[model samples]
Target: MAAEPQTTDHRKRPRRRGDALIAAILHATVQELEERGYAALTMEGVAERARASKASLYRRWPTRAELVMDAVYSVIPDPGELPDTGELRGDLISVLTRTARLLDGPAGQALRGLMAEVLPSPERMGQVRAHAQGMGRQMMEEVTRRAVHRGEISPEALAPRRMEVGQALLRNHFLFHHEPISDEMVEEIVDEVLLPLFNTSPVNSAT
Candidate 1:
């Protein structure tokens, strides 16, 4: 009898087909941004670089801000699902610090550059800010749920400012600076700043 052939999980394989055109255009946009910066990243240039049509690019991404944001996301990577490292602090540190590095590194510059252009267009700016806000909110919500699961604090203890602590880490470090936020820095910020500010202090029965 022939030995059974081993099989790899096709689910993990990279799948690119229908989305390839969008991916190619975004990839080209990143190159244009890196070489010519935002000022030169026109629809025509992106079309030329992507070997796609200007009409197609405009139909997909109507505005430069939209084009750049889509492109920037493709260039910079995001962290994977947050694993329970058995402690709330450790878990938040992992999620947030990775987030910080993403912002401080590749994505941040592009985001900042996008904002500079987007701000002039109020409608575009709102959409861009909303887009950014949605991502942070999702991550913070997960962090909060994990904190509750770890029995780190009373559910009510974290209720008031659950997002405040986690997102603030990203807001303060990434939005404000060029420094790559380190794990040690995240630990200190979470333990020193966040815990002290938001972690439950002893409930006094004397009240």
Candidate 2:
């Protein structure tokens, strides 16, 4: 006998495939950056690497800076994954350690070189600067929010600071390429330089 038709389970929305496309493009861009470095990294290169045409890439990204920014976004760890641990020291250390790891790799070298080359163009520099600010600020905001939620610091204290600690750490390497920045130094900077500044700040005073 023929079996009766079972009731269909419906209501599930079709999954968005755009993320996959973006992820693919991002991955391809990263590979190109690493293999070719900044000087050779191009839209045509990324398109060829990604198996898509130059037109497709242009539709999504009008400029090399924007494409590079998207690729950067794809690689950096999502803020949600960062642990709170309820202690500023631990949180800062964790993030720094991670940042160091990313910088120590090939992609880091490619990006650092790229940063130097793009300085000649005011327009390109502006685009790169804005992208960096958006990503860096967002990450710092996450850490600051965690600090307040855990009673680590006053909400006002952290917000006003604009999360310069991360910037300072990266600047150490960017500004002085030869100076050896150690993980030990990362801890020392966090403990010695930043911690004291926040502790005595008026914004952090008990509300």
Cα-based lDDT at residue 200, candidate 2: 57
lDDT of each: 0.69, 0.70
User: Model 1: clashing residue pairs?
Assistant: none
Model 1 vs. true fold: TM: 0.71
Question: Candidate 1 residues 1-207, lDDT tens each?
Answer: 999986554334454345887988888887887787776668888887777767778888888878888777664334346676777677677667766776764466677777777778888889877776666666656666776777766565554345555656666666578567777787887787666544564353113
The TM-score that candidate 2 achieves is 0.77
- For candidate 1, which ten residues in a row score worst on lDDT? 198-207
**Candidate 2, 160: how far from true, in Å?**
3.6
